[model samples]
Target: MIRTGILNPAVLSLLARVRHTNTVVVADRGFPLWPQIETVDLSLVDDVPTVRQVLDAILPQYVIGRIFAEEEFRQVNSPSVVEALRDHTGAIPLVFEPHVEFKRRVPHAIGLIRTGDSTPYANLILESA
Candidate 1:
């Protein structure tokens, strides 16, 4: 029985399998689903559980080495959204690549977490340290 930390068994299982340098994706609701990767869909409704909320939950439990995001995230999202994302990503090096390049990396990820966040290009790929 677990008393604290991540309580979701599916999420726990996914994180447990992550090795150093491995990546896991915390994606927005609109992100495309990849058939090759394992996904734990937590989306309930529009913005029910946001990308930030999922990041907040997993950050404490996971040792993240880097964060990969789409370059269009900054261009498409509002200033507040960008700032909020920055707050969640504190200290972890963030790399922005083209959206096409970002999707190209998804198939190799350990797993995908689907959140209800509607923020444009809010998806992130977190690499284990």
Candidate 2:
């Protein structure tokens, strides 16, 4: 049996394989869970398990250096989300990028966590450290 949070099988597998500097994605439901990238589908419904919840759970144990999100989220003034992240991990610097460019980055990520969140442009790229 697992001893802590984040017992999701797929998530555990990805986290196990990820090494320092490897990039991972904790994405909202709207983002596609591409087969090319290792995917952890935790979505139950429209908002079953949010991106924030999943990220918060894993950040405590994972050492991630950089976290990148769609540039749109920065423009939306979603400081609460960013603030919460600071509690668990170091600065998750926000980056603004074209939507197309953002989507293009996911497939190359070492892991992709699909959440049930509905927030716009809520995909994030987390680099392991």
| TM-score against native, each model | 0.96, 0.84
Model 2 backbone overlap count: 1
lDDT of 1 at 68: 98
Q: How accurate is candidate 2 locally (lDDT)?
A: 0.77
Candidate 1 structure quality by residue, lDDT tens digits, 1-129: 999887889999999999999999999999888988999999999997998899999999999999999999999888898888888899999999999999999999999999999888989999999
Candidate 1 differs from the real structure by a C-alpha RMSD in angstroms, to one decimal, of 0.8
Worst 10 residues of 2 by lDDT: 85-94
lDDT of 2 by residue, 60-88 (tens): 77887787777777566478865555554
